[model samples]
Target: MACRSCRRQLALLMRQTTTATEFQNVAILRQFVATRPPRLDQRRNFGSTPRQLGVRDIIAQVFKNSAEPYRVVQATEHIYKACAREASYTISAKDRTAGTIPKTAEGEDLGEGTTMWHNEFKLPPTFSTWSQVTMLHMYLIFARLRDLDREVARSWQRQLIDHYFFDAEEKMDLVHGISSRGLRHRYLKDLFIQWRGIIAAYDEGVVKGDSVLASAVWRNVYKARDDVDVRALAAIVSWMRLCLKMLDQIPDESLYFQTESVFKWPAKNEFMLVDKPVRELEDALQPTVTSAPAKAPVKVAAKATA
Candidate 1:
């Protein structure tokens, strides 16, 4: 099918063509273009007449700017399925080599030369990386919301909390035989790294931290900077949806302790220093505490004897 831009342009072309024959010619040209896949030749050339540039050209520009990540979570699922299949293996047999099999004069060997195949799983790094990137994007969006509305911010935070630890634990439980050490030590390790990166990004200006976190943060969040071509909002939405889907696969009570332990909400202010943004938000959402002092200060009397 012609791209949205091409279709829009064709409509305008029909309007511009005054004569019936010209309109027919334009229709034929549009049909011919539609049948062919997009090519450099089909693109508007510098030499093209003013008629070539119209609503289509304007739309192409608008569409280009309107680009956003779409169905990323769904795309991630497809990738996961591909990865799962790629890593799966089954037993099979190999062909017998020459002179390997014990055969009769007719060249039929009865279990003399034998070959076998063993099961194997071929895991791909792409799947893991994609999963991590999607999670990071999800966290970033939540981080952005943390500044906007308190309820929305809280929901996102809860989602991040519920998702990273609780949801993942459940999912990991499905493969019953999978070892805790492997799941905790390896998978959670990577997730923890992503989690820390999210915190670092969100608290870059406000928190007291080393530059190492800053330098490494962006790299961990985006798998390949070049591969991600979407608005930040769209990317996060895709990831959030993916996280929801992942929630279903999670088994009950997998391992939330390790997940929750990775991130700490900023400490609440007791003395009300220059309230930082997070602290301010926290204090507002939090209930106020009214504590009475144990003892009032006693007034000292001036010395009577000089």
Candidate 2:
């Protein structure tokens, strides 16, 4: 009998082997036969592609040093994975990639080793007011843990807040409200603040270099308002304000801010107008932040939880 055939028989016999020494020999032979030969012996060629991981992509995955915990860390990771899977289908559907892994500038296969969320919503169709709102809340939590560009984060945040208000009102069908007049004016007033803040952020260079957030926010905003009624828009803005308040109340120690920092005072002078409203909202929404034994800011920073 051939050596290979003999080995197979031995392996089969080992399964039923009752004698200890015989079983041991059979098992050893079976392992030898089943073991894969080295690549040179197999004579097969192999290659792998490489790419650069973006700063945002890395930050998105890391939850260490965050004021928040790992559960929120897990959620961000889950979202990224979900988005990545969606990106694969969407990119293929749009013919952006030809049934292969996409790469960033560094030639590393961009989507392969990374989480899904970054790739999937990198562009529209996946982008929406709801997504923007959800992500901003995540971002705010993250911001408290890290030092990011305060103005840029704030500008995008303001836009997302405005968008959610209008969106929430429309969803609830509370456009006319129980009192139609009170609804419209306050809603409109909030919308005006959001719109003007976003515009002013652009004018004042708050979003000067934040192309990614700026472009995405504006695209979603425009998509939400193609020939829609002015009142519908105002209602959307009001609804968004309520969401912003809720999001603001999300504890800094929550999992979402694991590696991020919430903007206490983003931008030098940008807070001048928004501070009052932010303070009022915060007073209503934020829990009393217990003092931590009056430690120095550096000392506080040192033992801070993520």
Candidate 3:
């Protein structure tokens, strides 16, 4: 700025010169005020294109985005959604005048659906039964989430149960038609206690053995009914083991995102892999020798009569 101002002043002075001698002398003199050069960027150049992210960097970013505090809830929401869908089953409203539930063709009282669980297993069509069944499924998801990093697993498990209560309370209002807020709140507290017991019982059952797990299922899902089907208890234990194996096969990255794909209900009368013997499990590992190709089916028809 100073140099520009001086240059302007010099020009004016030369223009106003009365004598040619002064203007000639000033023009002849070398420039005293030097012009400053333009500034240049000195930042280091990495490359023309931005550097690509590594596997670790991408993973860190993924974890950071999906597993953070409030964000974790949103990221793992699909897990709860899947659990809720699998666990959700409705009991049809009873016929007020008939004073009995709708019956199946065999004179058995039909449940909303899942004839095996409701009718065959003798589970009642009520809110409590629904809750017990829902909790059983939720525990399966909770167990798999336990395999993740401590904090990450904790977040997922917390949300899993939290979502359960939220849905339960909603059902209490909409489905069960219990409009009293205070009554609903009381029921929710009790349900929360039950959920805690379920987690402990299930974790112990899974760790010890199938018999122990069956007992847990007997108590939890069967509600300790005297006539509870032993086969039903066995079937639950088998399904749980199968679900855990499926969960284990899934990559950690897919734990929360695609976990719904693993929540499959057992087919009626379909032998689960858990119950099948390992060697004969789904005929996966058959005998290889083949009895020496059945001795080439020797032609001994004529020798038989001799």
Candidate 4:
């Protein structure tokens, strides 16, 4: 919201200082979300290691490269579509997350797509839920896009996020029935702010540890619910680690050629990402106090005080 045009477009900035901050008090987390993450956090990338670029990544800049601007647009569109679908695909009928979708008849395994998110994790299938899920998927891709050269990566990032806004605004009009463009813009601006928080929180988690990442997922997707299952959060962190590992193996040119086909999620009953480790290291998930045994004063009380 620095410039009027930026406010209108809901354009996200890497750094921002709100006009409201000048007058009203703002929380420190809000300011943290607006700025870049610390350099140490960038260096501490753990589960999501930076990919080593191949010839394709390096040669993407050549004039002879086949990925023209138009093709990149198409690729980004596919990515956006895939992510939007995946966001809602796992919502089991039992949770009533889908507004118009019919309920399951006994044991049908199909609704839209298959996963254990809604039923097992107890998340709703509402628009807010869908957007939060979509943001996670978007982050997976964003992490990968950062591996390419700077200008090219920035272009792709902008295109991918612009596609998200287009889809999100359409949903506000069609699904939620918000007719006012101005109102939708306001909502989108709020969503952009949330997206900033996601980038910061998730990045810090990847560099730090699963516990940290779990907290990020909890606060963002779970709405900081008191009753959220710890296992569910661990599963999600494991899933993201798996996604980044797989994404790291692909060449950068693959995303430019076709993004949707490259991005993959676990199908129904196929989650093998080892969330058990999170449980085994239970101490990591919560704080513990250790009581130290007292040593007798000074010389082990060998010589009693007079």
Candidate 5:
């Protein structure tokens, strides 16, 4: 057997070794944790250091004070381009022809004289339709920007409108075959006037109620036609309200960095006006009732016999 002193030294050495091993394990664990990727919900600071900043980012920051404004401009231009493309997309001839007439099982005419304007019921792919839709999206952004600094908001608004009109002018030249610069300028001027009018009319309607807003949409989009479909009008108004509500919920930073397809118009089936449940409001207004105390039973005195 080893002497008592020797056994004590061994025990001490073992304890030291175990302690050192534990420390090493802890250090390894700390390094692993430090290098681990961030969670999906967590936001990482892309501009935390100079090394993290890209050339454009650095330029934007140096010149514009913050890269956010430049990003907003880029995002707005992207949105306008997307809207322009959407507006210019023409309905396929086959689909248009199929929609105009109802046919039997053998492709025979069913003698139904009524023509189906299926494209009109939803968002149509035309310049006028695109303009209205693009304006609506721009309005939502403007609405959000109302809370921003006046100068900053004005700058963003100017850039956004400028990009839109520029794209519009290009579309007019290439797609619509308006090659004359003078004519394109005149058309752009008219469109700007219309845009201003739309903003004023729509703002008034939003302040009043949905009916008023629907009327404005009808007048602007349908050109105040007597035979305008009420369902289509209602759908457009509902879609506008939904889009505004969604934009309102998104943070400004997130909105500025949102993807190109983020502002896509809702599909026919998804077009809905989501409102808070009536029961929820009623519950909020009413107070909760607790159980009442049991009333003592009163014994009726027996009637005196006469």
Candidate 6:
């Protein structure tokens, strides 16, 4: 009987010890959980959540926000077309025949007199001259876009070049009377090669500074003529740098939509040339901001020497 009683006591003691041990283990686990640092919820949620919108995203959002892919493409095409038209307009001959020509004190035909181009740059009114000027403006925009997302830049550059060639082909048909598609295509192919060469040359010039840039302008745009005016070369180089700086200041969002107005050329006065050397043009192209000097604090007089 005593042996059986002792056996029961031993079994009861063992059960109690097991229960206590289990309770202590659970307590320890709870403490460990409570003291543990919070899990990185942000990291945990990263894969599930969408990324913040970037410039490219904002551009893509245009398509989504419109909900029509065709409309988005049409709008983009129209925008680029308008930009190309504006660029071409810079060199388009003004309708000098629209109004009566102004007479000087001497009854000379003012229209027959030397014009700005004749008086200053002496650039002839030729298709090549107009095309060069147009390309200059286009190149400025291209330079500004170099830092954009690769795909975005590629899309814009392709569209812009398309608009340019379209205009060029149309002009060839209408103005030059090259109605043969084969001939126009050949001309355009040549111009595309020229365009690529100009980009490479101009990029090199920009890296090397104003003198190198002027040399490129003379070579490509002026046809490397020995008689090319140094002053005109300097002026064009100055204008390019100025336009690039202006475009750089504009935000990417603004550029995506309002490109035509944003990329407009500066006023004639803004490009006025001084008699300084070409090196000075670099300084002229840089952005300059002048601020008013801080006012000195006013001194207060003591109470009438009281």
Give candidates' CA RMSD values in order. Answer: 24.2, 28.1, 23.4, 21.6, 24.7, 28.8
For each candidate in turn, the TM-score is: 0.26, 0.23, 0.61, 0.60, 0.56, 0.56
- Per residue, candidate 2 scores C-alpha lDDT tens digits across 111-219 of 2212122322223222233344343343333333233346424432333333344333442233112246566567556655654545444333323443333433444
**In candidate 6, what are the lDDT values of residues 143-210, reduced to their tens digit?**
87787877557655655665577678776765554679999999899988988888998999999999
Instruction: For each candidate in the order shown, give its overall lDDT on alpha carbons.
Output: 0.38, 0.37, 0.64, 0.68, 0.62, 0.61
- Writing each residue's lDDT as its tens digit, candidate 4 over 219-273 gives 9989898998776787788778878888788788787554566446553223344
Report the lDDT tens digits of candidate 3 across residue range 1-306: 466335533443343333333443344332221323234554444452112223344445544543354444555456666655543456466542354656543443344645355655567655666778778777887777778888568756765665667668777776656789999999899998998899899989999999999999888877677887666787778778888888888888876566777665652343444355654755765656555454566675655654
Relative to the true structure, candidate 6 has a C-alpha RMSD (angstroms) of: 28.8
Backbone clashes counted, model 1: 5
Show where candidate 4 strays beyond 4 Å: 1-67, 89-115, 257-263, 267-306
lDDT per residue, candidate 5, 1-306, as tens digits? 996446533543443344333454455546544654546666667656333444345344344433444455567667656544533444334544555534444442233111112264543345666677677667767776776777657656766787787677766765555789999999899999999998898998889998999899888866677888776777667766766776667776665655334456552433333323445688899999899999999999999999
Ranking by TM-score: 3, 4, 5, 6, 1, 2
TM-score winner between candidates 1 and 5: 5
On TM-score, the candidate that comes out on top is 3
TM-score of 3: 0.61
Q: After superposition, how far is residue 64 of candidate 3 from its true place, in Å?
A: 5.0
lDDT of 1 at 30: 70
lDDT of 6: 0.61
Candidate 2 RMSD to the correct structure: 28.1
Using alpha carbons, what is the TM-score of model 2?
0.23
Runs off by more than 4 Å, candidate 2: 1-72, 78-220, 223-226, 255-306
Pairwise lDDT winner, candidates 5 and 6 = 5
lDDT of 4: 0.68
